[model samples]
Target: MKRWVLTVLFLAVTMSSGLRADSSDQAAAHEIIRAQMQAFQTDDANVAFAFASPELQTKFGSPAVFMDMVKSGYAPVYRPRAVEFRDWVDSPGGPEQQVFVIGPDGRGYIAHYMMERQPDGSWRISGCYLEPLGEESV
Candidate 1:
């Protein structure tokens, strides 16, 4: 009985400290990505740009410019037909979220999102790179 209680307590403590728990961060990132994608679908450049990190915002200078770049470059992520969140992994820069998406053109893509955690504990998308999946992949 004591061993079982201690085991449960150990797990609770570890999970609470985020030692083995990452759903909160992953879920928040997923929500942010979804909202940004929705904004893109609606052509709301301002709303979509708001989810970008300060670094990207500075690089683009304005939401219009950012939207233009996305429309021309990231077609898959700009208007995906379907999206599924995959793995969240730690990297040298930070945590990365991989999203599997079916593009507007019916092409499969994997979007790697580099997430930046702001000072206020909010996450922003620092960058996204869409890699086309092979014809055999889905």
Candidate 2:
């Protein structure tokens, strides 16, 4: 009976620790996305580009190019009036978060953002795909 109690206590502590770590990672990922969005709002291309993954930065070549691409292609993301972050899904490739946003025109969009974890234990935006929320009330 004593051994059984000890086993249960150990499992409880281990499970709680794991949950805390997962929650911490989620918070960090959310912050990174929020910071990037703030940068976009301020037209701070360099700060926004810094939140991107190394691969994304390399692909864009420069912050100015990245900002131009975003302004042209992702207008809603570039200037979202409202944003509500949803679930964080774990995948073999990386973690993805779903964000509900209302653009300046009051149209709703679902922004799916993929996040990559750096070797130094920081999260970065690897990619994002936005879908229009058709007829959905914001």
Candidate 3:
């Protein structure tokens, strides 16, 4: 029947479009993380701060302050030697991106980045929790 054919066509298009959107989102999220990491490596706090959520930016007041906090509290993230992105998980707050990182001292860390979708539909880093990789896991 023509109706059945049209229904199937609509479903196919919708599913494909959804897939494309998800892939795009994933790419964008990964790019944000990469850019932020690059900024940190270069000591470009302003550039790095741009990738943060609005609330986070407000809380820090300035990029210098944010950078100071990162330097003191997230030393591994501030100077990660090896970085590998993992799965993106959905959370009630928004989405969380898992990143595997190796510090300069060669210790492994699992960084869970909480991402938020901005008003303009772009993603930003809301928060990050770094857990050291245990010997057994490594």
Best-to-worst TM-score order: 1, 2, 3
After best superposition, candidate 2 residue 101: deviation in angstroms? Answer: 0.5
Per-residue CA lDDT of model 2 for 47-109, tens digit only, reads 999999999999999999999999998988899988998877776667888888988778999
Q: TM-scores across all candidates?
A: 0.84, 0.82, 0.81
Candidate 1 residues 16-121, lDDT tens each?
Answer: 6673478889999999999999999999999999999999999999999999999999998998888889888887889999999988889899999999999999
Candidate with the greatest TM-score versus the true structure: 1
Candidate 1 C-alpha error for residue 58, in Å:
0.4
TM-score of 3: 0.81
lDDT per residue (tens digit) for residues 34-87 in model 3: 999999999999999999999999999999999999988887789987888887
lDDT of each: 0.92, 0.90, 0.88
> In lDDT terms, which candidate is top?
1
The CA root-mean-square deviation of candidate 2, after full C-alpha superposition on the true structure, stands at 4.8
